[model samples]
Target: MIKLTEINKIYRTNEIETVALENVNLEVEKGEFLSIMGPSGCGKSTLLNIIGLLDAPTSGIIEIGGTRTDGMKDKQLAAFRNKKLGFVFQSFHLINSLNVLDNVELPLLYRKVSAKERRHLAEEVLAKVGLSHRMRHMPTQLSGGQCQRVAIARAIIGNPEIILADEPTGNLDSKMGAEVMELLHQLNKEDGRTIVMVTHNEEQAKQTSRTVRFFDGRQVE
Candidate 1:
């Protein structure tokens, strides 16, 4: 579960101050698939980044699975994030040079896990995402949907409890997008992973367990 109270994210420069999130409060229950819907510049992705602890809120409290993150040091935050959260992005964030198996194993390199164990875990998750046959392929060799699947495999290989996805299907065709959504739904329903996704698709939002709408950095619904 995740909780955010009075969350505000502001970017300030010499003569300009922009509020990305304004006193936004949110709560995501365990095993819930939540969608955040909004137009561009409405802070949907900013909110997601804040919740994922990749960015800090200007003034607010963030609690994930009962642990308060506002006060955690950088090293502590990194360690906690590595263990408790997974991230998926529209851009796929895959290293072009690394093959599927190696990319999926990147997260484990930060931990004390051995190479053999990392490969085993990567293989298992790649299989879960139906990418077992493509493990040796490079990012340039895969389709958009396949790239996303590889990204998903990388995200889950650590078995993180929370998945934060931002515009996960933005770059794919409808068919590919649907396939990715099906995979996400399976992870949410069958694996019981908590997912908080930011999307612009109305139908996709409707499919989630709950949806929250935002406008001008404020949660409107």
Candidate 2:
């Protein structure tokens, strides 16, 4: 479903350049749950961002769902991202003022869908995450777990084929983290969603279908 060949990401300043990823090649099959593990500043999140199309690679080929995304303009990339990718962040980037349902419905607002249908889709995904009861509550009113659940709902509401989770369980307590992990598993296994997650927890990484370790911006075999 996703393939990267000879991908490299470099960040440059006036005098120094840092390598965030080096000659990285990876392929994730459809419905596979792949975990990326690395120490801080080792390019785990950078790799995820590149694969998610949030950032473009310096020079490489990125094929997602059989389409090459390398040379697309910004507008085309945005449309492709909306239709093919969903993102879950470590910070659970939800709007503080919007209710759970409204936040989940935000992704659909850009589409040619009606308000009523958006509401229905939002509620459906929230229900999938077992958060239908909190639909009207604001982000401030919810716990960390609830916030992430809301984030997950917002992500999958568009029914994107790939889910990119960057340190998804980083902020929650153990139990809540477990809950979110289980929810992700259900999405991958039952719903046939392709999941690529970056995580520090060894046990959580173990639970995934495969785990790839990184060091100093290179994949370590």
Instruction: Give all candidates' CA lDDT scores.
Output: 0.92, 0.90
Which runs of model 2 end up more than 4 angstroms from their true locations? 210-216
Off by over 4 Å in 1: 210-216
Using Cα atoms with residue i matched to residue i, what is each candidate's TM-score against the true structure? 0.97, 0.97
**Candidate 2 pairs with clashing backbones:** none
lDDT of 1 by residue, 2-46 (tens): 999999999899989999999998989999898888889899888
Residue pairs with clashing backbones, model 1: none
Instruction: Say what the RMSD of model 1 is.
Output: 1.1
Q: Give, for candidate 2, the lowest lDDT window spanning 10 residues.
A: 207-216
- Residue-wise lDDT of candidate 2 within 1-221, one digit each (tens)? 99999999998899899889899888888988888877888998889999999998888899999999978999999999999999999999999988999999999999999999999999899999999899999999999999999999999999999999999999999899999999999999899999999888879878754545544576644
In candidate 2, how many clashes are counted?
0
How well does candidate 1 score on lDDT at residue 96? 98
